[model samples]
Target chain A: MTPETVTLILDIAITISLVVGAVFTLVGSFGLLKLDDAMKRLHAPTKASTLGVGALLLASILGAFARDEPSLQEALIMAFLFVTAPISAQFICKVNLHRRSCMTPPEPSSDSTWATLDTADAGDAPAQHLTPEKG
Target chain B: MSFVDYAIYGAFGAVSLAQLLAMVRLILGPHTADRILALDTMTVNAIGLIVMLGISQGTQIYFEAALIVAMLGFVSTVAYCRFVLRGDIIE
Candidate 1:
């Protein structure tokens, strides 16, 4: 193909990627807002938003190549995001689980043991009104 | 305007609006975990916006910004989660 044709193809690819990435991010964020459960919210940002940003990063890489600069940094950024986004999501998920237990009615730890990590006193427990488990 | 130009602007607007929605969730979350989730989503959206901006500007610098944001956002999220999980950052 001619050089002009190649340029056109790259431009088109970049444009598509950009639009798709944006839509994915928006949908993911909307899920975060609308979803009622914490676990459910995890699905949106971890899967869709990550894919969205990944697409944009891919576009940036393509744009760089089209300009003859051919940057590898955007690729590195993509890799970093891929590695960290899940780990971050996992961490936040764990936090949510623990925080929920702390501030609400205690649940059995599956070992039949109630989770009483730091009962700092009556005042410390904000959700004391929540009935404690009777296991 | 060209198709590419339109895409750039549309991506910017969409991601920005998404970021706003995440902010609303952060403020209104009934549970601590919900707030944390909102914060994490915000960081992800911010990274997407930065990368989109980089593409639109045809620059390399914003790529660096996106990488930095990713690294720091992960660390902060992990640290905050750790605090909630263990009630302490160290030991």
Candidate 2:
């Protein structure tokens, strides 16, 4: 392809992706505030915001490519965010459960139960020793 | 402004609006976890803004800053949750 066509393609890609990313970010943030339950709040930023940032990073990659600068950093950012967002979401969910901050947690399957504050009713035990004792 | 320039402005404005909403959630949170979520969202939004700004300015340095912020945000979120879960981040 001619250089001009390539640049045009990149420009279009950047525009669409950035716009999509920003809108997703806005919606996710809105959900964070508008959702009544803490767990519902968790749903917004973890999933939608991660995707939003990924799209923005993609746009940045295209922008950098168009400008003939290094684009790898944008890819790295996307990888890092994708890898960590879920782990952080898990941490946040655990925090909510441990603190009993949410209204109600989902019921664990019959095979095994979760160890939330309500379920782990043992008194006087320190938080550090929360794991179930081995046989 | 050109259409491309206008697009950049719109993206930045939207990301900024998202950041504002995240901040409001952070302040109005009745639960600590909710606040943490809001903060995490803010961090991601900041990354978006930084990238967009970099695009608008035609620079590359902001990518490093974005990467650093993403790493730090993850670490801090995990630490906060660990504290809430077990009262300490490190055993």
Candidate 3:
């Protein structure tokens, strides 16, 4: 096969792979919106998007080789992405959970005010004042 | 439109829409985790975009950049998560 023909085929294949990867990413993003909770939302992007990017990267390597260029740099990029994205997501989630649970103690003055308000409200209520008194 | 190009464009359109939805989550999320997840999703999609760009341009540099982004994004997420869980960065 001629170099020209090989290049054409590689181009077609790479295009197809990249488009599929993009579609997967889009779906994963949609999952982020549709899922009810953080953990559930985590699933689509991490799993599906990772695979999608991998496909795209593979296509890149193929295209690079077709063009007679070295692909080590591209490979390195993929390696970096694969390693970092998930770990970052995990850290943020853990921080969020911790923040939600940390409770602040009420100030003493505010506590006293609350107590006074409660007692005043309770004292003003008549205890069955409408009932007829027993003779 | 050529069949292949049409398919590629369609995928791009769909993914863009999905990225928008994820952005909404990032903006409206009540908790940090949800926002972080949404951001991660966006980064992953960005990698996909870079791949597409690399393919279209017939170059390898974009792909290399994408891999780097993926690595850095992951490391940052994990580091922040650890910070949240432990409430301390050292020891």
Q: For model 2, report DockQ.
A: 0.61
lDDT of 3 by residue, A1-135 (tens): 998788678768876776777767777777778877555677788777777777767766776777687565666666766666566655554444445421223447645542312335544433213332111
Q: Interface Cα RMSD per model, in Å?
A: 3.7, 4.6, 11.0
After superposition, candidate 3 runs with Cα above 4 Å error: A89-135, B1-8, B88-91
Evaluated on the second chain alone, the candidates' TM-scores are 0.95, 0.96, 0.85
Candidate DockQ values, in order, are 0.58, 0.61, 0.34
lDDT of 2 by residue, A24-90 (tens): 9888998998988878888988989999989988888888888986557788889889999889998
Cα lDDT tens digits, model 2, B11-42, are: 88898999999999888877788888998999
Better of 1 and 2 by lDDT: 2
TM-score of each: 0.84, 0.89, 0.69
Most accurate candidate by lDDT:
2
Clashing pairs in 1: none
lDDT for position A106 in model 3: 47
Candidate 3 local lDDT, residue B37:
73
Ranking by DockQ: 2, 1, 3
